[model samples]
Target: MSHPHPELTTPPPLPENGLRVVALGGLGEIGRNMTVLETKGRLLIVDCGVLFPEDHHPGVDLILPDFSYVQDRLDDVEAIVLTHGHEDHIGAVPYLLRLKGDIPLIGSTLTLALVEAKLKEHRIRPFTLAVREGQRERVGAFDLEFVAVNHSIPDALAVFVRTEAGTLLHTGDFKMDQLPLDGRITDLRAFARLGEEGVDLFLTDSTNADMPGFTTPELEIAPAIDKVFRHAQRRIIVACFSSHVHRVQQVLDAAAKAGRKVAFVGRSMIRNMGIAADLGYLHVPDGILVDIKRLGDLRDDELVLISTGSQGEPMAALSRMANGDHRINVGPGDTVLLASSLIPGNENAVYRVINGLMRLGAAVVHKGNAKVHVSGHASAGELLYCYNIVRPRNVMPVHGEWRHMFANAQLAIQTGVPERNVVLAEDGVVVDLVDGHASITGVVDCGYIYVDGTNIGGTDEALLKDRRILRDEGFITCIVVLDAATGKIASGPEITARGFVESEEIFQQVIPKVERAIEEAVANGVRDDQQLQQVIRRAVGSWVGGKIRRRPMIIPVVLQA
Candidate 1:
């Protein structure tokens, strides 16, 4: 399955000067993440991700990195390493498989399981090379070590990359939660050991660098959920990310404390629980897992439904419940809790689901209404704390927007990191590391690939421009017939317009004037295709502008035959 776009005949060449780290994505934004470490003629890619586009982007599903620069050099590329199973970090696997499916993928057992599920869902079966915490592996010229990191999701890690030039610590999303539901905490001693061994360059997450304060512990939400379960007279439904094993444990614990039977609704939630239980990450009490089909037989107060669609994904269980399509409907007596923040650009979809759930007569609780959800990323204070712990010679902030990157860079400076030591990066900008000193080396051909339907192609700025025009003033199509032999008008010129005019009567009054303009263009003896099309376009545009008092996109179909 080849990508729709032309594959790069050659992968990007190694920097002629020294070791360089290139950020393909996750530098300026939250998703579609990728980072490249180039040294000794080898490249190790860390976490390929996809960014979900804004609502106004019609027909676009996601924004991916253009892999043309690395397509030709798939051999020099060692392995695709995953830090966690978040979509922004792993969503590009299918897209990458379509381009070069043979590359080995390395991650922890849980991350591999999630990726396997995603691959099966997409009908892609690529061979995986799974790794666990404390494991060391080699790919090309780079030696990789996986260090367990505490996060909202299971099996999140901070990758330690060793190259001939130096050692780089790529911290994936992490927090310092000592009492996480999973009982796995970040290996700070290991990071401290690495610091003692010496870190040449440090690339860390900056998603919360702008905020101030430590990330709340995951256990804090258990009491809130317990209150909901205890006070609710009817059934209780909790919606969240299916991969958050810690949060899942919290929900199950809360349900058990409230003496309610738990039933998993979404496939993702079920699969993750199965993995967590098998791996001993989740400690669900025996005989508490009830089937969803048996829900009607249970008392309302005894049932606690754990489901998915925290981001308001349309096909997930929560969305189906909101639309009244689920087998169990939330009546006036049920209490529904949204246990996650709406990912940016998904606000509209989240709001729609909320509206639908409210219409179904269920009480809804979210971040603002209740303390049901907390962010996984570190806040400003936590970011400063991590900076103080590592105390790298040079700091590169990745995984945030431009503003976030800048703010985080400032925070790094404030946290005793010298101003010169902080480097704010964007996609394709290469920061060269020479003997523990860093500087901008050069740029790479890094940009976004828009996925629209089955076709993956470069998003044209012109198309967006035309879409903006259509959004503002609508569109009008003008068809004109000109005599090929004598360059004269032959038949009646027709104007077909939609979304611009309210009624056919308005179009009828506007058509003749449009025809007269076309006749004038023919009378002026325009013969060339470009000239004729331009003339017709301008004439129709002017007429529509005068009538509607707006400039509609005028598409001219000129026929000579």
Candidate 2:
């Protein structure tokens, strides 16, 4: 198997009839999925998306794929083919369009609608082409075909790319659910046909490759959801991904059967479901839907609330309700159902929400306790079936972390794909497909571009480190007045601290240390104000690290008096 090597440098110019595959994101992580496919001097992008910020990423809104590799070549891009409507697959569309607005976006009808809705918020009227399953379109140097794939979201697609160098199949976050709620199973017959036509390289979703068996069908959750709705004594709140149309459909059906009026709570939940219903992907029973404002008119037993934050996003509706910060207070006799799988890295936050809701006397049901959720990605057995059916000459696992991808590669190898043909790569690693074989060529400067509120790509690691320090170790500021003539302290050395439990009296212990450091620095002919500040900073940092055993951010202000 080919792997990224530290010794690898800039890859040689693309060999004749070679397709260079560069992943700007989504190789090492579960989100921020994007890939740049270049051949014949033109690029075809698939699935531009975003990664949600975790607790460690303080104050960050979103994490985007670094477009530096293709920033200069936006004009050379042909079009972007979306695989699905999931945020991890389409959330970054607006950000990418901000760079080059005219890049044509191609996807299924529902997928395009979700993206266009998001793009509308960015005030970008994007150029979009809606295509469904079995449709083919030639975009620049690549011939693309869309295949229907069943996922948590409706109208998800697997893209088949044809070029002079090779044919690459990208299965964007899918599972083979024989009984999907929308009745759209992953088109394995198409996979077999593509295999017969000779697929040179297959890029499959590896999100659940480590799991052992087929994923439970979406239909299997209906009984459980019905049970929840039937047994709830009062107001029922169901939380799921905003884009999960199938789950929402299930919720609506259960609510209607239970004779409860449902209200969409979050802005995204209302928007996406509206789009899905308008586009015929979602089926909302008549008289079952009600406005959130009118929720108060209904009795507790007659009301159902469908909200976002199954993953426990702080600002999301369910989280706010859990924290008692929202208009919908979750309390005694209320039933809160988390109907989505817990996303990796969100366990703590989700558990906290669960505990908070439980503390408020709400009965909480989640994946661990009930069949409320099922994974949308294929497991090892399903991947094996895909590998054998696609029968590609080479395999490159995409859309998963290292373990998931490695397990996927093993599944491919077990299905008769040669071991050496499997390419294991991470974000920024470049792989080139030539003459039916894929190999890692080199790496690119694909780093995380942070989105903090309205600021895109403005937050960096240093700022995040400072935020962590402030959150964890706290910060201390020292104000000192320096005499111009003597280069010594002329007045106060006032110290203040935040985010730590240390007292003002404890800070007094470091006052003399700061004064002595300034005096010694002045005696050594260090008169520069900035230099004096560094001296004071060093003194405070050393004292805090030794006495308090915490390395908080220390700010030293040297003012001339």
Candidate 3:
């Protein structure tokens, strides 16, 4: 089944009089997320992110937001403010710098450190500015304050943008973690202060709006890992997100308490751990972290392995370990704990890893049987709590899918926000704030841009259409002979097929049928490269469809020479 692409509607020109918020991405998906705030011709972008893999796109590395709308308005973009160091929040920095060189990027120290590392990897440098809690800065006509918020990652912040139109709060992905691993909680007092100050519009994360209750704190998972580690007779391996430095720290501390030495395995996990430790964000005791190469020197019971690929990323250390391709392998009596949930579209890959691990006689624990992993975004109750605390006249749900946004909007209405004030925004929909009231003024051209290797290109309906065709139909190639003088078909048409045919006998039988069709077309005086190619293609398509009950992409190459 094919999903219809949303039509591109041009947003009503920015109101010359009020503040406007536009979400380019992260409104109805998990990645390639970005949001723009325009007040009096100045723009402040919040959380440039990249989307993870999807089902149809098997080998895609990352998907980024199409910045055509903002590309032309780069001068108007005062700053790109980040909320955290998660890939979805900071992954697009390299791409952004590739397009627009050295714009002022602002975030917390940890977040900025990660961004700097990412930029350095790309051989591009940017003007990075660190933002701390309560640090207010002015960019153009907008006065912004970064309020620290707790989540899976440390130093997460929610942006409070004060404009002439009104006060707007853009909550980057956050949760009400009263007992976060970092010991810093989401500031309820600050939220209440903003509410008291009369917030006009609230842009909040809707990633978990459909789920009920507040997300469990990161500290809660430590005990579970400790318990598993203490009782495990053999080695223990934990798979998690590399960017979750706080979670990694928890795992390390738990390993220490269990009297096990930990080893970082995956490339991303190793790189991030080095960064966090160097910056004093993560504290791994000396002699606790040994090189993976030196794992043989330690006892199995004393080894605690922390690696990446919880979502079953093929090349991730955990996945490779499960398949016995990794240098460090888990055998019988080993415990493999998946400390992260299987993100949507990654279930199959994750299950493959699980099956591989089970094949090696290892015990596996996940969200189903263990309290190892918890969401980083607020659930329905927490969403309502944030809504009540912000007390905004307008509530715009960002950073989730259509269902999540709809559920979040419902929560807003349930919390006394008017139904009309609850706006369901898509990629380019712009909501204008006028005199404390908000309305969808116009649409903008906002969509996804796929990054293939180093080439940046559009990921439009046409591209998806081709992908679907290739997936469903396979591919067909036809070679036909034509008279160069008259542009007429003269000889036979040969057909070739792959990824579709089952046996050599069946394919051979189909070839004669195709040749006969070409003969018939030539007898009918079919000529002209364009016309001959079309005739051969249509004939081959019909023949293949009738024989196999499938429509393959028919490529007819007519030779005039």
lDDT against the true structure, each candidate = 0.79, 0.92, 0.82
Better of 1 and 2 by lDDT: 2
Summarize candidate 2's per-residue lDDT along 1-561 as a digit string, tens digits: 888888878888998799999999899799999999999899999999999999999999899999999999999999999999999989999999999999999998888999999999989999999999999999989999989988889889999999999899999999999998878899999999999999998999999999998999888888999999888999999999999998898888888888899999999999999999998988888889999899778999999999999888999999899889999988899999999887889999999999999999999989999999999999999999999898999999999889999999999999999999999998988899998889998888989999998898889999999999999998999999988777777886999998877677899998999888888888898889899889889999999999989999999898997
CA RMSD of all predictions: 4.7, 0.9, 2.9
Candidate 3 yields a Cα-based lDDT of 0.82
Which candidate, 2 or 3, would have the higher TM-score against the true structure? Answer: 2
lDDT of 3 by residue, 1-561 (tens): 011135635566666778988887887787778888887888889889898867676446788887887888888888899999999888998887787876899999889988888898889888988989989998888899889888888788998989877889988888988887778888878998999998888888888989987788777787787778877889999899998887788888888887889988888888888988988889887779898889899999999988899999877888888888978767899999898876767889999999999899999988889898988889888888888887888888888888888888889989899887777877887788887788776677776688766667745557676777888778888887767775545665666776675753565566666666666776787755687678778777777778788887888888876
Candidate 3 wrong stretches, greater than 4 Å:
1-9, 458-472, 483-492, 523-525
Residue 198's C-alpha lDDT in candidate 3? 85
Query: What is the TM-score (0 to 1) of candidate 3?
Result: 0.94
lDDT string for model 1 (1-561, tens) is: 001123323234545545778788887777989987888877788998889876566657788987876788777877889999888999888888776677788998878787877888778887788887788988878888889898888789999888878788999988777677677888888887777777777788887777677888887887788777778888889898887777778878888877889999888789878877887778898778899889888999898898998777777899999998888787888888889877766888988988899898888888878788777887888777777777777888889887777877888788787777777767877677877777665577887788877778756656766777888778887676778897766764677777764764576676666566656766786577677778777776676677678887888777886
Error of 1 at 543 (Å): 3.8
Q: For each predicted model, how many residue pairs clash, with residues at least 3 apart or on different chains?
A: 7, 0, 7
Supply the TM-score for candidate 1.
Answer: 0.89
- What local lDDT score does residue 422 receive in model 1, on the 0 to 100 scale? 75
TM-score of 2: 0.99
**Sort order, TM-score high to low:** 2, 3, 1
